[model samples]
Target: MRSIEDRSSGTSGDDGSSGDSIADAAKTVEEQPAFQAVARGGFLMGGLVHVLIGWMAVRLALGDSGGSADQNGAMAMIAQAPGGRLLLWVGGLVMAILALWFLLRTWFAARRGHEVKAAVVDALRWSGPAAVYAGLSGMVLRFAAGGGSSSSAQTQSATAGLMGSGPGRALVLLAGAVVIGIGIGFVVVGVTRRFLRQLERSGALSVGAALRITGIVGYIAKGLALAAVGALLGWAAISADPDRASGLDGALTTMAGLPAGVAMLLVIGVGLILFGIHSGLRSRYQEM
Candidate 1:
């Protein structure tokens, strides 16, 4: 065999080629350092929050509604355990911390780039906490308030524990509003920067442009859904009678009570589900 330096794995320009490869990779990364950095930051704040919400919704759907927040009967299931209570408070703190981290991350992104939009940065500064805290309320209300679903056993599934009456429903509504505000903040900022388009141009993806679009749009839609859900819950909390106990019954219950307003909320809910479907389908083919 020839000497090692002359071998195929160690050709004449091996060292030179290796150096060039590294330099090229580094140059590519630094070219859009700001965008890459912001993507990480966004993942921390908003992306993490969305993941948590999805988890919560899935859990709630599966009969693990956490606390009795909306479950009159099941309240005892979680509250009876002292450890579970502590776990809840810890969960809330974790969520709040992540939210705060994201807020600061965006701020830092703008600061680092020296050219980030002032308005987008400012909007990010406020919306993270507002949306996160509103999300936390879903848990607190469940564990602490013992949501007041109606006596019917089946109605217990969809109802939030803390949202059993007029005031409670009102709080849900406000939470929805905050969530919507946060979503709009993201959509506006993302569009202004042409975030998704730029990524594709930069060769950051392999495939699924159409699917990625669906996912991105779905994310915004989810934000809108949060607002609508909050509003509907808020209305239900206020109008829902403890004695009336709508339980886990979803939009149908509201429609029975407030035909006009409930009708509108139901439409919003349907739109949200459609977005969810879009997201789910897109996720089937997405990479990250």
Candidate 2:
């Protein structure tokens, strides 16, 4: 019979071999044409959603329409267009593929050697983008399947439910704080042009001044929107009122109620449009 030490060594070798195989498989999939196509398509889908939301916001700013002014509103708009459902199906599948790709990429990245603290931070940061992509994919699929829900309504309902429990308010507050921090980070990334790090310098430099301009405006606008949403959530938690926590739609609407609100909305709307363009460009120029 084999000694216990011999069995342990054999098991270790098996584990090491399996890990190497997985790493190689991930690398091959990462370089595949099909994977690249889907990843780029996912970026386009994101851009399309942003464009729709921005257009809706522009209309709302001009008092031309009153839509949800969020991703849900974007879906509704898409559904009204010709062959929208088909596009939604395609977009959903692309997003799902992108999410899986991101997961694999993140896994490979985490396995690389680095300081423990740096690795942890990198993992957390990448996990956020992965989560966002996954959530968007799920949302797209739901819309494609004709089982959609208003983002604002969902957020409010969630807030309301949380407020019902003894520790619910605290939980809501914690969530609000986290979102606010993310918003601030977004702003920093924009102002510092840190987003360029994700793109190939050679490709990004070809865009010249426009890239810098759009990157700055887009990040700030998005950050502000996120901050507004977080503030609303925090307020709702404090007041014990879910109605005040109506998510992005409510936050944008609130902005419309302020002085020169229309002008502000128009500016923000333009910023979002620029951001959409930037996102689409990323599909072409991203480091992948």
Candidate 3:
């Protein structure tokens, strides 16, 4: 048999040098300013999306009823606008970049020699948003390819399918609960002003009072909207009525149907717009 050094050397080929190359490559990519810019652009695109969706929700609140008040609705509006397709293309590209950026961030964090549990949690945190960014990128690309607009009807249909079977129905209920939990987490983040930690300290401090106000209001509104969607989905699961399940569009509409519902929707709409503005600033000020 070979000596220990030979075995170790052989093992390096299988598990060491290539891994170092990947980590080095990740570090190089992370160091590039252009990559950072693309990530920022992706954040800006996300902000613009929120702004558009909020505007649509506001319109619906005012009784226009012209379109859905969600991401798909926002895509439709963008497609109709001058140079909308170009915007979608650019946004989609940047969002894809953002997803990669998130992965890089997770990798860097995991390499910090932190406790395994903490690193894993951090990885999961980054991964959730990475998945979201990836999904948004796909949606933008789909619209650019003339795949047509998004609709909450799709959500309802999926919910209906889930409710058709016992196992599926249980999964739907679990999903709704998870959504609610996410919404509550958002609320906690907002109320506790934890989001500011994501921004560069100097940049965040320089933005002043408006940023804080917007961040707080925006997060709360979004949290409430998500909670409403989750509640609706749970209700649908319980009632065996998939039609009762909806996304943001449905949630806001349901709010509109309640006492002072129109006013509530309008408020939520404004809150969403504020969130968009906050997101836009974050694109510039994020610590990366």
Candidate 4:
């Protein structure tokens, strides 16, 4: 019979080996060419969405009452176009795949033998993109199914629900703060040109100036938009008015009502388009 100490040691070794095997498998799946291709397609799909949203924003600024200037608006616009539903389905699938890839990356990052703090940070970084892509996938699928609702309406409804309770209002406030933090992060990334770290050096250098310009403008615009969104949410919580929490569409609309808001919207719209262009480039040049 084996001694208890010896058996315990063996069990520990087995567990360690099992963990290593799982990590290795995850890394292998991540390295697959097909997976990378799907992820790149996801990036392209996201870029297309951003471009559409920007166009809608321009239309809004130009006094076109065509659609809401947000993701739902973009999807609605796409749905109206020829073969749009099919495109939405495909894009939804790709986004789902990309989200899965990000989750895998999060797992890999956590198990990379880094210090606990570093691993946690790395995992958090990957997880944010995972959550974003997953949300996008769901939105795309919802529209692809010919069943969708206004983002602003959904936002207000949710905010109203949360505001109905004290703790819920606090949660909403927390969420707003988190969004603002994310927006600030985007600005920092743009200003610092930190996004280039995810691209292939040679590929990034090929269109260096254009990439840099678009990336900077796009990030700042996105950051500003997000900040406005968070601020609106916070306002809604404070004033107990859910209508104040209308999301991106509302944020833009509110900007439109400000003095020189049209020009600001136009700049933001153009910047978003540039960001979409940057995303397209990233799809091609991103380090898998």
Compared with the true structure, all predictions reach lDDT values of 0.42, 0.82, 0.84, 0.87
lDDT of each residue in 191-260, candidate 2, tens digit only? 9998888777653455846677878898887887788789988988998889988677778888888998
- Rank order (by lDDT, best first): 4, 3, 2, 1
TM-score of 4: 0.92
Model 1 compared with the native: what TM-score?
A: 0.36
**What's every prediction's RMSD, in angstroms?**
15.6, 4.7, 4.5, 4.5
Q: Positional deviation of 72 in candidate 2, in angstroms?
A: 0.8
> After aligning candidate 4 to the native by TM-score, how far in Å is the CA of 87 from where it should be?
0.6
Which has the greatest lDDT?
A: 4
Model 4, stretches more than 4 Å misplaced?
1-11, 203-206
Cα displacement (Å) at residue 3, model 1: 64
> Model 1, range 1-288, lDDT digits (tens) per residue?
242223334445777588557646644543454534433332232332333334333344444535321223333343456765554444445445434444444443433423335545555654654465545435444555544342234333344664556555565556545545755764563345333432323243544454355445545545544444344544544665322333232322333245364444344334334344443442233222
Model 4 is weakest, by summed lDDT over 10 consecutive residues, at 1-10
lDDT (tens digit, per residue) of candidate 4 on 1-288:
443334434557778788768878888989999999998899999999999888888998999867989999999988889999999999999999999999998887776654667777888988998999999999999999987777778889888888888888888898889889999999998999988887777634558777789899999889988888898898888888898987789899998899999999998899899999998888887888
Give per-candidate clash totals.
30, 0, 0, 0
Candidate with maximal TM-score? 4
List model 3 lDDT by residue over 11-84, tens digit each.
65657687668889888988799999999999889989999888988998888988889998888888899999
Q: Which stretches of candidate 2 lie above 4 Å from their native place? A: 1-11, 203-206
The 10-residue segment of model 1 with minimum total lDDT is 67-76
